[model samples]
Target: MKIKTCLIQDSPVFFDKDKTLDKVEQLTKKYAQQGCELIVFPESFIPGYPRGFSFGATIGSRTDEGRKLYSEFYKNSIDIESDDIKKLEKLSRSEQVYLVIGVTEKQQVNGSLYCSMLYISPSNGLLGVHRKIKPTGTERIVWGEADGESLVTFHTEIGKLGGLICWENLMPLARMAMYKKGVEIYIAPTADSRKEWTATMQHIALEGRCFVLGCNQFFTKSMYPEKYRSLVADQPENMCPGGSVIVSPMGKIIAGPLFGEAGALVAELNLEEIGLSKLDFDVIGHYARNDIFDFNVAKQPEMVKENPTPKR
Candidate 1:
């Protein structure tokens, strides 16, 4: 089966969830009209990615202004059960497309937030969400860690869909976990726009014998609210030059590595390439030596307990 896919490389209406979602609706409609079945948005495309802002944290000190900024950010973040998410789900159903997008997810009980990938199937209202298990670098300050429960792959009509977020793609074990799940469409919504990032995407496609879709936002300092522009004043105008791309199972760049722009990269992915690519190199199959190496993911709490915990 061949699936028509689109990767959106555009910034959001920073700190404005309503306006950002409106943009999402508009873009989704535009691409769906082009017959794209799977449409992906960049990381944190709902409200926006916090590019140059630091939430005011020294080793032992915090600032009130930063706290206020964080409060504003939290307000803009989306709750999974919120009408904003429901709107996205309804859009997927109405457009008849499988939608995958990155979001800043807010916990209802606590005020904590998570960088999450939300999956919506046209046939199903909402599929599920995969919270970034480990937020990279300073991201740890804003987002909480996700448990094994979120390291999941969904079986869809196109194929088995799964992925890691941004730098999490560097985690070999994490990639293995997805490969073990037989992921055929590996979706990576990332903030990394460095040219080197494309190499990583290609490697994942080759390693897993799966198609890889990498999406990122093309953002600029001016894109932030005027009041918040000072936070990124020292940085260059172009904060992130979007490096969205699509790689085939054989490590071929099929779609793009769109940079310095706001647009969509559309491509048709042949599912049969997955099987052909694996015929020679299947990391979880013919290429793996499970008998020699004991690998485990915390898919269950007890799975972690299987190994002895070191004394603190």
Candidate 2:
């Protein structure tokens, strides 16, 4: 089957929940009208990514006010089973399109948040939600750690749909896990706008022999609060340059580098391309020599701490 996918590269409202959702809805509706079967959006598309602070600030810098803002943002974030996600679920069914969206997902119990991706099928409903295995640097202070249970690939009608958030794409073991699961169409919803990131995506497409849809957003210094203006003063032109792209199984750029604006890049993917691309360098297929160079990945051991009684 031929898979028609579109990547929506738009600037999400900075810490504004309702407005961001409105924008996403409008864009999704537009893409749906274009006969796009699957649409991929950028990381933390809802209530925007905590771009400045989450990327490069100390935990102490998160003042009471900042914490309150984050708490509000967290509260604004959609629950996995919330009505907002259900709306998107219904939209998928109505539009008869598969939707892969990135959002700041709030955990129900502890109320800790995670950078998450939700895979909603047109026919099958909510398929899977994968939290970023490890938040990049300062992001750990804002978002909670993801559990071991989230690494997965959802079997969809289009293909084996799977993804990892932002910098998690750099993690070797994480990529290998997805590769082993036989991910056909890998959706990379990232915030990285560097030229090198594009090269990395291209490499993965060739290495994994899977189509890579690399989606990023476009943001200016003005999009952020005035207090953080000095932080982004150096790179004025392409702060979060919209380099949303789609690479073929052969590591060829089929759709974009849709830079400097909010737009969508549509590409027609033929699954037959995979068979030809895998002819020479299939990571798990003909090219792999497990016995010759086997590398083991170590899992983190569970910690056991004793509870201490309070002194009277």
In terms of lDDT, which candidate is strongest? Answer: 1
TM-score of each: 0.95, 0.88
Model 2 clash pairs are: none
- Expressed as tens digits, the lDDT of each residue in 262-310 for candidate 1 is 8999999999888888778989888898889887777622111112223
lDDT of each: 0.88, 0.81
Model 1 scores what on Cα lDDT? 0.88
In angstroms, give how far residue 54 of model 1 lies from its true place: 0.9
